[model samples]
Target: MKRRDFLAGTAATGTVLASGLATQASAAEPLKVGFIYLGVPGDGGWTYEHEQARLKMVKHFGNKIETKVIQNVPEGADAERSITQLCLAGCKLIFTTSFGYMDPTINVAKKFPNVKFEMCTGYKDAPNVSNYGGRFYQGRAVIGNIAGHMTKTNKIGYIATFPIPEVVRGINSAFLYARKVNPKAEMKVVWVNTWFDPPKEADAAQALIDSGVDVLMQHTDSTAAMAKAKDAGILAFGQDSDMMQYAPKPRISSIMDNWAPYYIQRAQDVMDGKWTAKDSWLGIDTGIVQVGEISSAVPAAVKADAMALHDRIKAGTEHVFTGPLNKQDGSAWLKAGETASDGALLGMNFYVEGMTGKLPS
Candidate 1:
């Protein structure tokens, strides 16, 4: 063989090897994902549910992704700062798991066009920002059914986080079902205004108990209300995650929010370059909102009826906000056999008939 021919062949082989190494390096880089939480994972409610979903996603993706979490991030300026930090840190996708983070998510997303943002329990959306939440009203209806049947005082209490449409819709849905099962059932609401303040939640629970409330519901994210109910020897429903540890008594059935599937799908979409901004309000039909097991504390007939209602809703045969409903002022809201539209439910402000007290302006 000629010397020059051998040298040329060796050079070609070296170039090909280096190019192959470069390709492998590029392929080995993992997608970076971030999550912002309103409270600690140990909160045992809303944040716990999101944390569980995150863990599930981690297990599913394995080494294909890297995850970063910022917990207990306040909603306003702090949220914006945390999200921006994640974006600057090279996060290609971020999930802000709280309603209050909506504006901050949008604001951060505008500055990071290449990054995708998902806001939970929020309505706002942008080209890079998607919104999602569970149709918790459906689950709440089941809770109300249990409450209506289980309550000895006919009075139920609701610990509301905020006066937003989301909380209002849950209150109204629970009341509707409670009243349907027991005409004498009445709901009293106490707005704590904070999503995860244990002290405030406990105080609200005590106030409701003092007012003759025997069964309690909450839109806030905490186990404080459950503790209060247990101490008071009353009944309550769990929120976000199953509080079954307190079950068989104070904790009867529960409304569980399952966000694992959604999180995994959205992350997968990001990896596949198919992530798109959209609104998702999934419920029992999609397994996003689940009804926790009804304890033996409830009457067998009541448990059967509650499960039937759950099945009907899941089968789309029953709507939580059906017709034959009226506004708080006694004005007709829905005629018989009619159901509410998504738009109306999204923007719901006034209370339905039979509700007392003024909604915050």
Candidate 2:
């Protein structure tokens, strides 16, 4: 969706960050930045968060920058065509915002070697391309702590979008935090398999609740999951963006993907002739991944505790994946004080101990 608030902001287009040369430490050059989105910008979740970052980049650079965005872009052939079109149209710094666009991004980047590429939420990194994302798992930790205290059944339901590491890691993060407060707490995940389908997501939420989950969560994009929770009078955490508005009656808190600042910073690096390929995986400390207002559905005292926990994470005094953990198979996954690393986090393939569900093939 087009954002009206971005009326005066600058946007990225074309190719690499200050890709034209940057032979001199300082050069006054205008840059065109290109952005690709997997869904309509107004889907109100995943795509919206990225657009916010685009608008901020616009505002940050002003006249020296221009942006070209192609929304509702599909992942396959359409992606190759879009990248070609943007490159032909003169985008020197291209940022493809979805994981599916990864190879198309590399394909185009190879053809337009002069252009720099940055793929959000993707793993492939070329000399001209880098990846960036946040520690969404950290937000999951905050929600898990609340779930442990709020659930009457000690059964927390998660409506997961995929078996990809991102979704799996979030499940583990929430489970990690919950077990600390309630040792018997268990997480049950229902994978909807797609990121943006509302009907399937709603069905997943209903199925979980039917199985006796008192608290719910989701990694899917639409508001259907929350709506389902509200209808059933179950508590649930929000996702991607602050989805509280959709299910005010049941929304307990939200894991917000705040992407604006990173966008601005990356684009500014281009403007200032300091752009380079680097992986930026930021978290609560950088104000990138955030959990918004613990709802009144959560008791005030518990809210205080959650915030305290949040602060500890921010200060690096606490890590969500610390040792002394177990997999769902009853095997030890971590020793106390032994935290899982980025490598393991990125390729997580198992469920933690106590989660009742099967991973989809």
Candidate 3:
């Protein structure tokens, strides 16, 4: 069911009761599961993927579980209230699917020790709270290679959502791979500061196109940039979802986050009373970070090379953050043959060498 419809129906019927209470009336009642979404599933990006996984999970356990979702829940105090409502409404497991919900998830988990909480793209945990994210840089390297080989103007545009480590890591990974394949390729980044704002994303894409960028990439969660790139007759990559409707012209490829396996496993764990607080950061190697099909617009040779890189990364034969690399100031980071550690990547704050402009403070 669509989140909006479910919410409206629940509000109209006023049936927000705890599961434990329902179980008293009928011991066969299904376990109550809940989700907090930063945006509606219709956004067709981040939340859409989560919503798909949620449906898959529900189907996997059919009559064994029931789900309640609250859409468009912002971070901070509002997130806390939404989470608390889920707990009060009898959700045995709750997934807070956004980085900004880290603190709020942790805070609410403290009050509901019996409830299991999972935070996506966050770095915090409690006895009842666990964190999980994808190593999307692996997929970024592949798309970056495509961008490098395809950009006629040698300028690639990136629509960024925020200056957080996740976004920064994507930019660095994409730029490094792009430069590796095409020495003349330069990345031009524009921060829109919001994840799901289509208008802002479109503006950023237009600005980049006006500045001579022929290839567009985005870390934001909308098709706005792709639409803008299409209108300008430029090549682009999709984010989070397949978004193949504009393929063969603008969207030559895409990076997808496959959350089904992880979601199913966590739900099963909760059902078996084996759920634990642990961190899971999966990548292309585990099928969590996936590369969508390369469109026919890409030259056969370029597509082959991109897929070869993808296989190498998945096989652990290549590391995206290998050095000799430097920070934006030309200071040495990883020496030749040395690779980046998870610690460094998680706290990455500076731009890599060859990148222009300051990272937002």
Candidate 4:
């Protein structure tokens, strides 16, 4: 996935080139950027969104940047290998786009101090490494509201990808908002232990539908669940990008992860010699995570309510994990009118109140 080089244009011999322009062109060698993905680009979910952003970065920079990708890279030791290789291959800036890549990215950054690293959805940062992720829970809250109003059965199924804080936060946010709208709503979770397993996702969706789940949500990356929801005449929300093609009705709305702006900014930062290691968790306010269109199937009033909530979040007037929240144990988590802290949310381990089922070890 190397970025194509810029075409070598000829200089008019008679025209003396501007001093800074010539020097800038000569100094601006194509930056080698590397992207590491846990799943293939066609997963149609998380990795797909990341890849889209990478493409956007490429397009924005054109020949000023040369980006390479190592997809289907497993987390753990394998991730270390990919990061090391990318750094060795002259990738000055590398993005490891997976939670599991945290430790590996940090380790590799130590080995290559000059190489800048970005880890997506992970909480590790160093002088050469930074962390960035979308506040996906914000989007989940909107979908949860939709599910509460739309579900024929109060049993909503959530296909979880892993037990990490990111995934758990999404699940809790969905349940919290859904319960607020429909007090009787219940969330059933099925952990697939993988990010983009289509077969497993389909099986989980089938199980949920068979068990009378009228609405489904997933942290897994695939359209299989949406397809299953369509077949079962149930409602579902798109996880990362829009998956409406497979099941238009079932896929009522989606959480679009908009990574282009951030990607462009970071690449431009490098170009301007202003890149730095920092953690960013942007949501509707910054267009990092957006609420997809609410289908006509959703009642006009309910849709309006959801959109209002979306707008409120975008305007920074509301918080997803607001006051009157509790832990799975019924213990006080957030006091009335209190909001959750980013630190607590980032290290979230327990499920919030109103959601049953033990978190897997």
What tens digits encode model 2's per-residue C-alpha lDDT throughout 171-237?
8889878988988898887777688988888889999999999999888888888888989999988
Over the stretch 224-329, how does candidate 4's per-residue lDDT look in tens digits? 8888888888999998887767535988899988787777778767766899999999888777787877777788999999999898988889999998887999
Runs in model 3 with CA error above 4 Å?
1-28
Misplaced by over 4 Å in model 1 are: 1-26
TM-score of 1: 0.92
| Predicted structure with the largest TM-score when compared to the true one | 4
Per residue, candidate 3 scores C-alpha lDDT tens digits across 94-148 of 9999999999999999999999999999987699988899999899999999999
lDDT (Cα) of model 1 = 0.88
**What would the TM-scores of all predictions be?**
0.92, 0.89, 0.92, 0.93
Q: Give the C-alpha lDDT of model 2.
A: 0.82
Query: What would the C-alpha RMSD of candidate 2 be, to one decimal place?
Result: 5.1
Of 1 and 4, the candidate ahead on lDDT is: 1
Better of 2 and 3 by TM-score: 3
Better of 1 and 4 by TM-score: 4
**In model 4, which residue pairs have backbone atoms overlapping below 3 Å?**
none
lDDT agreement with native, every candidate: 0.88, 0.82, 0.89, 0.85
